[model samples]
Target: MSPLSLDLSPDLFPALTEAQADPDGPGAHRPALHFGDRSLTYGELAATASPLAARVAEAGRIAVWATPTLETAVAVVAALLAGVPAVPLNPKSGESELGHIVSDSAPTLALAAPGTQLPPALAALERLDIDTSAPTTSLPSPGAPDPESPALIVYTSGTTGPPKGAVIPRRAIATTLDALADAWQWTGDDVLVHGLPLFHVHGLILGILGPLRRGGSVRHLGRFETAGVARELSEGATMLFGVPTMYHRIAETLPDDPALAKALARARLLVSGSAALPVHDHERIAQATGRRVIERYGMTETLMNTSVRADGEPRAGTVGVPLPGVELRLTEEDGTTAVEAYDGETVGEIQVRGPNLFTEYLNRPEATAAAFTEDGWFRTGDMAVRDPDGYVRIVGRKATDLIKSGGYKIGAGEIENALLEHPGVREAAVTGEPDADLGERIVAWIVPADSQSPPTVDELADHVARRLAPHKRPRVVHHLDALPRNDMGKIMKRALTHD
Candidate 1:
């Protein structure tokens, strides 16, 4: 079959129409979404979203109360069908964060499930409660909006300051999904299962809309439990998508749970994203289930840049080649010269330019302009190295993960990976502290498997030195109960307080 092309136009909602038509088979009657005991067929999903789309079409922009339920999925779909920009609000966000988002995006209306109590931050907005049981209405044949038109105003995690909305255009979503189809060998016959939150791109965009675009089905676990994932996959779910945290739990359970291993072995695809899957977990899961989990690289600003191709080797510790139509390169820290050679030793910041990139930061033109170079490459601020064959291995983020020690540009990710391989270490994070001799010294923060008999700092340092190089070993160590992590399982290095 020819690769799916997304360059034709900007109407992403048409895929839903074709999905309902059951072009590939009896897709219209097939289950499109499943959350707990509730489910929706492709036909039902379209019917339920049409009337709401009509009502929402008049609004310039709308806020969606993003709960991990079928209603949240339907609300986002309705906004897309109406060609209105949807701003997803995290249900678990604090009052201050929610207030900041509301004031920043200035959404005219807020859409939530029927009977959902509005929070103080959203209570002031005009509210529209979605009733999924409402009868279907015929939508006016409004053609596709301009490809450049804003489809979403997704807010960033307010790690730096107040959250900034990233204006994701229709073209970016269409292109990224189509590119994934080409890379993953995705088709209408596939059924994807995940339990990720609906507020982020990984869950809301890729997990939900990806299946719909391919005329496939999705089953949401609602809450991530290994047994639930195994049950669904055993019952004919073709793929499983999750972050590192979920996979870590799965890895821990696989040794004692043969049934879970068997179910995983039956799956066609196992993907890990949002954060890097530690090599230790990768090896452990592969040993028990004989299935290698594929890793993909992406961010909120860039929907997806690269992924391990379904037909390609499932190499550990690498995120594979760039997706079709995505132009990727590595530039020096100065951001002027591009690193052309791929010796896989030198680490440089990743820069990309593609239709998959967000248009701009909403109401922050200066920040948006600063994100791109004069040549139009979006400065991703992620440090990575490429192999001779073009596979990109991300070292870490430029800000927190890069450590300059004794004139060597070291990446903390490798040290953390080496530390995880130690039997006594359950979790690990690495940072650089000011050092009088080496310019910066490597520090290891560890969660030990046995608190009473934790590995000594010298032993852990030697383990890293032997696994990698002596220079990469940690000079100082601190034991912690757990690493500070975000919802996606990515370690929040900025949250760590140094003594």
Candidate 2:
């Protein structure tokens, strides 16, 4: 990798050019992005974005119609270059959710691909058409914006109430990307491939910007297909980033497809994030192709906190140590006291103090204040256990996955992992149901491998009892055609019905 200034800059896009140029580096002449058959060279990207950036420079904050297209990529780049905070609107969002975001953020203008149709919520806003083929003039200099100035206003999933917009400052993006570059050994030479959505942190921030920050190139699969992944990796893409769902599909297809396995084996890195990758899927992929899918942990509020280092052991089920400049700790479930020791058995709520953290929850100062501790550590509300080695194993979320039953505190993640090991179980989710005897009994929601011969509740109970503790075993089992999962493949436990 070429020597580049790591200093926090007013604009991030220009930093890609400052890195030492290799003849074959991801630069002006090299292909920067590929979506379907369409491609954009670094030079083309800069030219396209420069004009758009100049136009939107005065817009306070703009809403981006984030579809998996070159226009969406260019729109975000333009916003960053102009030093404007961009609020990425998910194309899949319903009217109510979409309305909430637009009303909350109150962006001056909405940007989308030329000739694209927008829904009523966004149609109300002034629209700016992004034309990548349009002629460009000289690019404007990135004037000094405060390092703490908002760069992106990302909304939460709104599982509790209306989604809150996370105010992501320029510093957070720079810190997170740099820390990841250090951990992943990312460089201008690497070519990343993924088909994740543009609206989320996993896709837009890490999948796209991470490469650009490191002077590397990226190829968007347009949509994630196992075949597409195989094709890209086989054709010279160096890294693959995806969620657990994508990996699960790859694992299921590997036995019948040696070419796919071989293609994956050749990649420099395969990363899974947004949710935990089941131990079963992790082992299956490793057994098929001698490579372990590395897992990382982060959220919309924090760009990225921890990742399994490229040089470190690709340990299954653990999201490795905290990233550089991130100070992480686990606090008691009560949220008062901090855990002083790492025993790998005790579970606590993960709290972090880092530059990667968002500045605030936009227009919601009360919510923002409630999210942090008095001394300023963000209470992540994620339950995790830390090994003696400092590796973190996220058990689940504090509100849903941490079950207090009878006299013990249990994490549903371990039980869910154990259930996935059963040959008859294709997928599993565990939740604590109201119980008469114990305070709450464990309930296992299963999507069977074979519907005709689904594993019985007693059999699943016995399996979990044998693998984990008896107390952790499910008291009841429910079968489903498929688990309700988000775009990132995280099972939406709250969506499950129990009666």
Candidate 3:
């Protein structure tokens, strides 16, 4: 898709051109964003953003209190228009975490909704109010800056240490969104709907900016709800994006709510990401609404690696092929690259080289240097297996999801998927514990559908043995009322324990 060049476009948001062409054209008057009772058309977005863009251009790097609001969207748009890098801060981050981000990024100013009460870390910075309804004089798009220059500084979840700032370039944003558009057949006419936070890539880059880049409209629910999804889809919205938790809620209520099921059935696309959507949830939604939820794979460092194409078979357990212009490989533990899986079960660490990758970790040269190979490929810590047809199925994180049991390399993801198929299991997470004989023993943590009569360890182990293999069976089982989950609905396996 244009030779995989970092020189993606002279103008990042090309759709803004429509605002200049016709002040009252269809594109100009078209709805650009909807959050609760508030909305901003394309015309309004440009006019409001242009003046703010000019204001922010001189502020250097700016911090955006990324609440899911129209003003937050405008703030980011203005930053991009002015060629200033924006760092989005998650409102949910604790004081210490926020302090780490604030100091690590060292933004010159913090921008937020007029009334947002930022924490001490952000409050310490010079404050700029982002007024979405402010009067404005629209200016033409700025001449392109270095495509490789930092456009955004996104913080990681910090499994190892304080969160590192990932420096995402403008080229990566353009390349990733365009590649996704090609895979999903995205167009200007597609009205997208979701209720995702504005801090992460899935929510901000893909959820909000993706729609804006395509010249389409987005209706944010302010927060995700089954009814909001239903209402939006039934009333002409063509696409829906959400995490597994949102879809799980949808699947749980679909049997009793025929209206919700009917509305979901009418939507053009239902996409899930941030984590794998359980096979049970996938099948339940499909059974009720004939809609197969497609999954894509990405991380903070890599914008998006692969996605199931709209025209391709929407497989239940795979993240499909790599997007156009992205080169992906599965590297064996020994360091050799494996292009295709010969046995269909061999797993390796996923590494990618593409324009859709971040340039560096903001201030940590050593960490940034270690993130890539000598030849330029970014070594993604996630492990996955590639099929003969090039479809990728992520098994788990390289550090946590890969389990060495009885001399067999097993992915915790497949075991978790199999455990979820059991009638008594409502949620499942698989992990490995040190075993004297087996090197590492398989362990299963389950949140039972019927907690009072939870499935026994023997019965669950036998179930996994029958479905998968004896080596893959869990040797130990832990039952919890609810598995610990992060904000994105990802199971926090590190927090689970048999103690």
Largest lDDT belongs to which candidate?
3
Candidate 2: segments with Cα more than 4 A from true spot: 1-6, 14-26, 134-137
How would the candidate models be sorted by TM-score, starting from the highest?
3, 1, 2
lDDT by residue (1-499, candidate 1, tens digit) is 2354666475575556854445344655767889989988777787788778888888889999998899999999888888899999999899999998999898899999888988999988999998777354334424567888998888888777888899998889989999999999988889999999999899999999889877788999998999999999999999999999999999999989999999999999999998889999999999999999999998889999999999998998889999988999998988979899898878999999989999999999999999999999999989998999898988888999999988888888888889999999999999999999999999999999999999888999899889878888899889999999987788999988776
Superior by lDDT: candidate 2 or candidate 3: 3
- Tens digit per residue, CA lDDT, model 3, 1-499: 2233333764676677677556677777888989989998888898888888888887779999999999889999998888899999999999999998988888999999997888888777999998788464577656567777788899999988999999999989999998988899889899999999999999999999999998999999999999999999999999999999999999999999999999999999999999999999999999999999999999999999999999999999899989988989989885556646645689899999888999899989999999888888899988888887888999999889999877788999999999999999999999999999999999999999998899999999999999988889999998888888888899988898778
Question: Order the candidates by lDDT, highest first — what do you get?
Answer: 3, 1, 2
Question: For residues 35-152, what per-residue lDDT tens digits would candidate 2 score against the true structure?
Answer: 8888777777776777788899999999999999989988998888888999999999999999999999999999998899999998778999998883533364356677789989
**Model 1: which residue pairs collide?**
none
| Deviation of model 2 at 194, angstroms | 0.2
TM-scores for every predicted model: 0.97, 0.96, 0.97
Model 3 misplaced regions, further than 4 Å: 1-7, 134-136, 337-340
Q: Residue 356 of model 2: what lDDT?
A: 91
lDDT of 3 at 189: 90
For model 3, the local distance difference test gives 0.89
Taken over the whole model, the C-alpha lDDT of each candidate is 0.88, 0.87, 0.89
